[model samples]
Target: MLALERVSKTYPNGVEALARFSAAIKQGEIVAIIGGSGCGKSTLLRAIAGLDRASSGTVTLDDEAISSPHAKIGIIFQEPRLLPWLSVADNIGFGLADLPAAERRGKVARALERVGLADKADAWPRELSGGQAQRVAIARALVPQPEVLLLDEPFSALDAFTRRDLQDHLLDLWADTRPTLILVTHDVDEAVVLADRVLVMRPRPGRLFDQIEINLARPRDRNSPLFDSFKRNVLTSLDRSLDRNVPDRDATQGPGQAMWW
Candidate 1:
């Protein structure tokens, strides 16, 4: 399991981005973290990725402390951030340099086929489209088979159609390994479509406000009433997180409950 115990972060300039946030995520679960600006969504993700250390508390994967980047953790940013000089195949296999050449080549070849980029193996980053580049980025991150993966608004830069396409594609790839996924996203639809549970955070020294469990099954219907219901619950929670004055709908329903079901 991946666990965050009282994790907090305070910048050198005295800005407290996160405060005593804690959650225990099970293996192979997909969890989305959503919140308004300065809510520490990215900060929390970075802390988990070990890209940044928390001011207090701890992040551990399978009981191993993570104060720095660990082999078990992989992170993908909003941009592809691929090396311009490297080919698509090379970029995907970048992390497997320690492996023998034949092993590295075999893994990269399989990843290319998996991402449907086999024909673009020799293509440069500048030569690919926005969506294609992002696919390459996803392949690179997944190729390492990390125990946990952190995504920070990875598909935000693409068009709506492409974004949705990649979302489904990501789920397909995820099924292959079922790694623990921790995503930070602002899109409510994206959160509903991809996450098993949606974690809503409050801003200004960010902390968990509410968590809504999405009980819908795989290959979810975007137009289904249940999906919209979950979306509304998340939106309502987001509004309340930003401003506590927003009246709670169905006050009897507890946090993490799917009211429609």
Candidate 2:
């Protein structure tokens, strides 16, 4: 299990990105964190991934302390970050730095197979489409079979159709490997469809607002009444967030405040 305890980040420019942020991700479970803009969501992901150090907190994987940089944990950021000069196979094997040539080749082949890119092994990053590049990024992260997979809005930049396809692909990958997955996203439907638990975060000093357990069955139906109900609840929570920010003007209120069942 990966745990974050009382984690806080304070930049030199006097920006408080995170404050007392605490959350834990268990083995074989997918957890999604959702929040508004500038809510420290990305900061939280970076801290857990060990890309950025927390000002005051402890990050632990199992019983071992993670105080410094480590590589067993893999992070996929918003951008693909693929190497322009390297082939798809070579890019995926970039993380296997210390392995021997023969072992690296085997691992690279397997990783490509996992992401369904075995046939495109010789393709360059520029030659592949956006979705393909992202898959390469995922393959790179999965090559080592990481203990924890940290994703920060991996689908945010893609178009709607591509986003849905990638989401399905990610679920399939997770089911096969069963890595502890933690995704940070802004879309509530994406959170509901992808995660076991949806963690709602509030902005301005970013604290946990709600932990809504997704009780819907697997292969969730986005158009069914059950899925509609789930979406309604999340929208309600989002509405509450916006209401809190608006001024107390009863005359200016709209009529669409009615709650859905």
Q: What TM-score number comes out for model 1?
A: 0.94
The residue pairs in collision within model 1 are: none
- Give per-residue lDDT, candidate 1, residue 54: 98
lDDT of 2 by residue, 216-250 (tens): 88888767887766665666565565445533334
Give candidate 1's error at residue 146 in angstroms. Answer: 0.7
TM per candidate: 0.94, 0.90
Cα lDDT tens digits for candidate 1, 1-261: 999999999999999999999999999999999998899999999999888999999998999999999998998899999999999999999999999999999999999999999999999999999999999999999999998999999988899899999999999999999999999998888899999999999999899999999999999999898988888889788878878555556552344433211
* Steric clashes per prediction: 0, 0
Global Cα RMSD, each model:
4.4, 4.4
Cα error, candidate 1, residue 216 (Å): 0.6
